[model samples]
Target chain A: MTMQNKLAWPKKITVCEVGPRDGLQNEKVLLTVEQKIELIERSVQAGAKIIEIGSFVHPKAVPQMADTDEVVKKMKRVDGVEYRALVMNLRGLERAEAVGIKKAKLTVSASPTHSLKNLNKTPEEAVRGFAECAKYAAAHGIELSGAISTAFGCCFEGRVPLEQVISVVKCFKEIGVSELSLSDTTGMANPQQVYEYSVKVREQFTDIDWVLHFHNTRGMGLSNVMAGMLAGIERYDSCFAGLGGCPFAPGASGNIATEDLVHMLSEMGIDTGYDLAEGIAIGRRVREFIGHDTDSSVLRAGRCSDIVIEQ
Target chain B: MTMQNKLAWPKKITVCEVGPRDGLQNEKVLLTVEQKIELIERSVQAGAKIIEIGSFVHPKAVPQMADTDEVVKKMKRVDGVEYRALVMNLRGLERAEAVGIKKAKLTVSASPTHSLKNLNKTPEEAVRGFAECAKYAAAHGIELSGAISTAFGCCFEGRVPLEQVISVVKCFKEIGVSELSLSDTTGMANPQQVYEYSVKVREQFTDIDWVLHFHNTRGMGLSNVMAGMLAGIERYDSCFAGLGGCPFAPGASGNIATEDLVHMLSEMGIDTGYDLAEGIAIGRRVREFIGHDTDSSVLRAGRCSDIVIEQ
Candidate 1:
C-alpha cells in the first residue's frame, strides 16, 4: 500500500459543480426552474467547465428535481461547457435526450443495501438493468458515464468491499462507459481507502476516466480529494454552498463545498479554473435563494484571501 | 515540489487536544473549574495521551481562562499522560508551577500586526521577551514549548513571509525550547503551503519536534493535516467540539474538531488511540454544556462507521 502509490499532484483539475442537481435534490425548498437555470449560467460565469444541471428522475421520488427538463431546456449552455444530467433508466435518458442534454450519467449503488433502499433493486440488478440505458445512449450518441454510489462505505451496511466496487466497474465497462465516478454518497470515505481504491481501479481500468465525488459528512471530503489528487485522479464533483444532506444521516453535510474546494485548490497552487471570489458570491446567493443556511464554510466565512475590512 | 514528497504515511499520530485551553479561552461561557477537570479526565479515559488543560493567563485578559490555576490544581493527573498548559510570561509560568503543572507552552504571533494587536509588541520583541520565560522554565524543570500563532497568515496582516516564520523558529530555538508548533491561528493555510513550509522547517531544524495546528475557517483544516502528515509531521492540535472561535473572524470556526480528526485518522488506518464512540459522546456533552452547537462535523453527524439502524 505504501509503494509510493503516488506523490504526483495534478497541476490542474476539473471541478464538475453538482450543486444544482445533487445538492438541491435533497433540500426541502425546491428551486424554481429559473433559479436552476441561473445557477447553471452563473456557474459557467464562475469558470466551471462542467455542471450537472439536474436529474431526469421520477417526479414522485425527487419532487425538487421535477423541473430538470425545464432547467436543461431553458438554460444557456456555453460552447465547450459540458452540461450533464443524471438518468436512472431508458425513460430518464429519453427525458434527458428530449431536453437536449449532451451528457447523461447513470448511478448504481456499490452497496446492495443502498441499491435496494434507493433504487428498489440489488447492485447486480441495477448494473444489469443499465445495459439498456447504455445501448440507448450509444445509439443516440449521448455521452453516458456511470456513477457508483456508496463506493467507499455505507451507513446502512458497514464497509463496501473493494471486490464489489471492482465488479461494478467491470459491469460499467462491459456496458461501454469510458468515464466513471466513485461516489462517497454518505461521506464514509477516508484518505487511505480512497488512495488504495483509486490506485487499484486505475491499475485495473487504465482506459477509464475517473471522477471522485465525496461528501463532507465527516470532514474528510477535501482530505479524500487530496488523496485522489495524489493518486492522479483529476476530476471531482462538488456542490455550491454545500447544499445537500445525507438522506440516511439527515442534518449531516452533503457534498464537498464547491467554493471551499476552489478556495483550497487555488491556495494549493493547483489550478481549478474557478474564480474563487465569484464562486463564493454565488454560494452566498444560493444561501439567500434557499432561505436557509447551507453547510458551506466559504459561505459562512469568506475566502482566505478576503480582506477583512473591519477586523 | 514534484519530488515523491515521501508519500510516507505515519502508522500512528499523537493528537494534543487543545480544546480546554485554546478553545475555552475564546468561548463566551466560563466553564467551571470542575468542568475543566472532568474534560481532562474524560479525554484521558478516551485514550488521549496528551492534553492542554488550560492556560495561566491574566484573568482580565481572558475571563474564561481565569480559573485555569484552579483547574490545574484540582485535576487528577494521570501518570504517563502529558498535561500541558499555555502561558504568556514568567508570571504565568510561576502560577503553573505553583499548581504543579509540568508542561507549559508560550505563544507568540508570527505576523507582526498580530503581535502588536494581541501582545502589544512586535514579533521580534515578543520572541525576545520569551528569553526570561524560557530561563525560568529551564530553572524550574518545566518542559517549555513555543507556539507561533498566525504562522500561515494573519487576519490583520495577510500572508506572513516564510522568512519571518523561520526567524521566529530560530528565536524559539535560541530561547532553549526544543518543540515548536506552527499554528494557522486563522484557517488561512492550504495543503501545498503547509507541505512546503513543514518540509522546509523539518529539514532546517532536524533537532526540533514540530506540531501542525489548524483551524477549519475555510474548511481546509483536515486537508492541511493530510499535507502535514505527508510531510512526515506526526503531531497535531485539535479541539474537542470545535469549541474555539476566530477572534478576528468572529462567526467562523476555530480549531480542527478533535473527534473529526480522530474519525478520519482511524479510518485511514492511522492509529490515534482514541475510542471513537467515547470521544463523540464527550463532544456532545460539551455541546450541551456550552448550550450551543459547535462547528464539529462528527458532532453534527455520527462517525462514518456508525450504522444507521432505522434509516
Candidate 2:
C-alpha cells in the first residue's frame, strides 16, 4: 500500500565505475589529464570504489586516454579501493604495472573478423597475447580480468555463434585467467541471448567470477544487464552517464548508464552501495563538462518519483 | 556472417500506436484537433493497424485531447485498420460512439490509490462502469478491451501487491472481457514481476487475447515488454518516437519507441512486418512536428549496422 508497508530494499551491490577510461575514450572532446583525474575523484567521492582510471593506448591512437599513467597515479587512493586500467597488450600491461594499476583488463574480440579488424590479430593470436598479459598480471600481483568483446552479435559478422564465444572464454580459462568479463560490444544482446550465453559460460567454469559489459546501442543494454543479474552475476561494468562506446561500433552509444543502473537496482531493493542522487548529479556534471548531451535518460528526467507532472 | 547468411528476419509485428491519446495527454503541448488528426494519419501511413486515436474525457481535464471527436471524424477508415479511443465513463463511451469509433478501451487502475487519484472511482465502481461498456460494445458489435493500468507497480503506492493485480484481472475475466491489455502505468515493473504476472494472468484465462502496454518511466519498460513477450503476449502498445507518458505518474515517459521495438523484433527474426528505416524517419518527422526531442534513441542514432566505425 505504502512504501514503508511494502518490500524492504535490497542490500548494496558492487558497482564498477568505468567512465574515466571507457567513457572518455569514445568522446570527441579529449579531456586533459588533470580533468580526467578530477572526474575520477568526483566519481570516487560519489561512492565508486572501483574506478577504471584510464587506458594505456598510444596517444596517437586514443588521445583522450593518453595520460593513463598520470591519471592513475594522481587519483586519490582510498583504503580498500581498486584502481584499474584498460590494457590491450603485454606492453600495455607492463605500463599499467609500472603505474601501479593493481587491476587491469585485457580485451579480445570473439568474432575472428572483428578480432582481426579491431585488434589486427586473429582470434588465436589475440588470445595468446591476452594470455601473455595474464601471465604478466599474475607475476606482478595485479588482478587480471580478461574481457571478450563481440561475444553476442558482431556488427561485421552478424550473430556470432555461441561456440565462438565459448571458445574464447575457454582460451581465457586455459590461460589461468581468474576473471572474465563478457561484452555485448554492439548491444545486440536480448534477455534470452544474454541468459543463454551466460548459462553456457557459467557451465564451463563454475568457480570464476564473470562480469557483464553492455552497450545500450539497441536499448537492451540494461535489459541484458538485468538478465545477467538474473543469471547470478553480481559484478557489472557501467559508465557514468553511460559514457562508453567503441569507436569501432558505429551508432553504438555508451554502456548502460551508471545512474540509471544504480537507480533501477536501488529501487528493486538491491543494495548498490551508491548514492543515486549523487550519481545522477555527477552524471549531469559530466555531460556539462563534455559539452554534449549524454545517453543517460534518468539524468535528464530525474527519478520517477522526483518530478510531479500535473495534467 | 552477413545479413544474407544470417537467420531469416521476422516481419510484420503488429504495432498499436497510442501516441495521440496516451502520449499527448502526458505532454505539456496541447495540440489542436487538426494536429491530432495529422499525427494519426502519419501513423497510419507508417503501417500502424491499431491506433489509439484519442480519449473521450472532459476537455478541461485533458486539454491536449480536447478535440477527440474532430480528430476521429477526420480519420480515413481503411479496411482491416482499427481506430480506438479511451472511454472513462458512459458519457465518454457515448461520445466515442457518436464519433463512429468502432473500438474502445476502458482502463481501471489496479491499485486503489492510483484508481482513486487517476479516475476518482473505486476498483469496484470502475469495474461496474467497464462492465456496462462491455455490454454496450457487444450489443453494437463494436470491440471493447479492458486495460488494467498500474498492473505491475504504482508510483503513488510503491509496489503493487501481486494479489491486488490478480484480483483485478479476475474481475475483468468475470465481466466476460476477452481482450485485456495490461499496462505498467508508472514503469515500475521488473522482468521477474512481469514474467510472474503475465504467466499468472495467461494461465488464469486461457482464451483471452492479451497485450502489453508499458511506460519507459523507469527504463524497465522495454525489458518488461520482453518479459511479457516471453510470456506469450504478441500485441503491444507503442508510440512513434516514444512519445507518451502519464501526467499523473511522475517521470512517466513515452511508450516503448515503435521503431526501436520493430528493430529488435526484426533483428531477432521475429515477423513484425514493419520497415525500420521508414519508421525511424517518420519518428524523426513527428518529433520535428511536435517541436521537441523524443525519447526514442534509435532515431537519433541510425541502425547499428548502418554505422561504419573502424574497429
Candidate 3:
C-alpha cells in the first residue's frame, strides 16, 4: 500500500467521555442520580461533545448504574452535546426509550465465553437477541450504535479470532447499525495488533463510523489509541481519572484516562477539543467522591505545558 | 523520507536494567545489601545484559543508596552481563574505581535549574566538572558513558531547548565520551517530541551510542519508548516493577517497567533477550520487599498471552 493510504493520521479526534456510564458502573461506590448528572454536566463543560451517561442494564446486575433513568431525566442536556446510553437487550432498549434517551449503544461480546458470562448468551445468541432492540431503536428514531466487547481479546478465550469479529461486524451491518465500536475489554491488545486489525476493519467496513475503546489494564491503552489513530481511526472512548474496570475480568484495570489521552494528543498537535486542565479537575473531584485515588498521571504530574516556578 | 528508512523498527533491542540503582535509590524503604544483590542477580538471570548497579553519590544526600558499595560488592558477577555505576564527579568516580567498576556513567543535567538544585552547579559547570572524571575513567580503562538528565524536559526549567541538549552532547563528544543517554527526568516527554528530537540527535551524533530513559510520571513513558524505537534507537533504560522517581521533581512516577517494556516489545515481534515472566516475578519480589505496589500493569494484569481459567 502507498504511504498516503497506509499512514493517515487524523487531524482532529472525537473523544467520547464514558466516565458516568463505563466508569461508574464498575465502581463499588454507587453514585446518586444527582452525582451522575453532575459528572455528565462536568464532562460536557470539559468539551466532551459525546457522553455515555448511563446504561439500561438490570439494576441488580449493575447496582451502581441503577439510577440511570433518573440521571438521564434530571441531567441538563446541552444543545450541542449528545448523551448516549448503553443497552444489552430489548428490555434495556425499552428502559432507555422510557427515559427518552435519544441515542443508545447495543453491545455484545465478541468472545463466546465472555458473552456467556457477561450477558448470559453465546456470541451468536447475543447478536440475535440484539435484533429486537435494533428494530426498536430504528422505529423510535433513536441513534443506535453496536459495540463488540472483547473485540481485541478475552480473558477467558485468550485471543478472539479476527474472522469472528468480522462476522459480528457483518451481523451489525445486516442489522442496520451504522456505527460500530471495538472494545479492548481485557486490555490485551498490542500496538501492532491494533494497527493491523484496524486497517483490515477500516477497509472492510468503509461506510460505518468506527470507534475504539481501550482499557489500560496492561498499560497499552493510549499506545493502542495512537496506533488506531495512525490507521485513520478518529473516535475513542475515555473516562475521567481512568475510573472503570471489567467487573467480570478479575485483573482488569480502568479505561484510558480522558485527561491523559487529551494531554498526549494535544502535545502531538492533534486537536481533541477537550480542556485537559478541566478534565483533571473533574478527575480530582471524582476521586474525592469515590474516596479513592485514581489511575491518572496527568492529574498527578500536571500537563507537560505546566511550568514550575521556583519558590 | 521513504517509509523503509523513516520507520525502521529494530528487530532486536538492548534493554539496560536500571532497577538496582535507579529503582532502589529513590525508594523510601531501604533494602538490605543481600536484597539488592538478589534483585541484581535475578535481573541477570532473566537475560539483562547490561545492569546499572548503583550510583556513587554522597550517602548523606541519598541515604537509601548509602549501601551501594556493599550491594555492588555482594552482587554475583555473570560473565556475559555488563555491570555499570553512575558517577557525578571525580570523588564518585573514585568510589566506583575502589569497587573495580569496569563501566561508569558520568551524568550531568541538561537544565541549569535542575543542575543547580541537583548537583549544586549550573549546567555548564556540571559538564566542566565531569572533565576530570572522564579523563580518569579513560586512563583507568573504564568504559565511560555520558548521560544528560532533564534532556527531554525538567520539573524546574520546563522544556530544555534542543540546542542546549546538542551543546551538551557536543561537549561530551569533545571530552571523548562516545556513548550517551538522554533522560526524561520529570516524565514530560510526548511522542512527537521524542521522535523529532531523537531524529535530530541521531542525525547529528551518528557514531555515538544513544540510549533513552523515561519516567512514566505523565503516562507517556512507554509511548515515548515506542517513538524512539521507531526512530531507529534500540537501547533503553528500564526499572523492574517500574521503580525509581526523581526526589527533586514532585509528582514524578517511576521509570517505565522493564517487564512492561519487554512484554510490549516481544508482542510487537521485537526480541529483547529477556524473559518477561521472570521479570514479573522479580517485580513482585521487589514490591514485597518495598512494602508497596509497583506502577507496572503487567504485574497486576498478567501478560497479554495469559488465559484465565475460571473455576
Best by TM-score: 1
Tell me the spans in candidate 1 whose CA falls farther than 4 Å from its real position: A1-7, A117-120, A307-311, B1-7, B308-311
Each candidate's iRMS in angstroms?
5.2, 9.0, 5.2
Output the worst ten-in-a-row residue range by lDDT, candidate 2 chain B.
B1-10
TM-score for chain B of each model, two decimals: 0.95, 0.90, 0.94
Per-candidate local distance difference test: 0.87, 0.76, 0.85
Ranking by DockQ: 1, 3, 2
Of 1 and 2, the candidate ahead on DockQ is 1
Best by DockQ: 1
Can you write out model 3's per-residue Cα lDDT over B1-311, one digit (the tens) per residue?
A: 11211234799999999998899887889889889989999999998999998889899987777888888777779897889998777898888888878899988889987788876987777777778988898899888988898898886777788898998888888778899899987788888788878888888888999999998888888888888886779999999999986554465578999998999888778899999899999999999999987788888878888755554
Question: What does candidate 3's lDDT look like per residue over A58-172, in tens digits?
Answer: 9898998888988888889889787899987788889889988989998888998878887687877778777877788889988888889889888788778888899889888
Query: What TM-score does candidate 1 reach?
Result: 0.96
Clashes of each: 0, 18, 0
For model 2, the stretches where C-alpha displacement exceeds 4 angstroms are A1-14, A28-49, A78-80, A205-208, A245-252, A305-311, B1-14, B26-49, B58-74, B78-80, B117-119, B130-132, B170-175, B203-208, B246-252, B308-311
Q: What would the DockQ be for model 3?
A: 0.42
TM-score comparison, 1 vs 2, better candidate: 1
User: Candidate 1's residue-wise lDDT over A1-311, tens digit each?
Assistant: 22232245999999999988898887788788888888889999999998998899899999999989887878888999989999888999999999788899888899988788877988878888889988888888899878999899987777888899999999888889989999998888888889888888888899999999999998889999999998889999999999778876778888999998998998878899899888988898888889988888888778776744346
TM-score between candidate 3 chain A and the true chain A = 0.94
The local lDDT score (0 to 100) that residue B228 gets in candidate 2 is 69
Q: Best candidate per lDDT, number?
A: 1
Give residue A159's lDDT in candidate 3 (0 to 100).
78
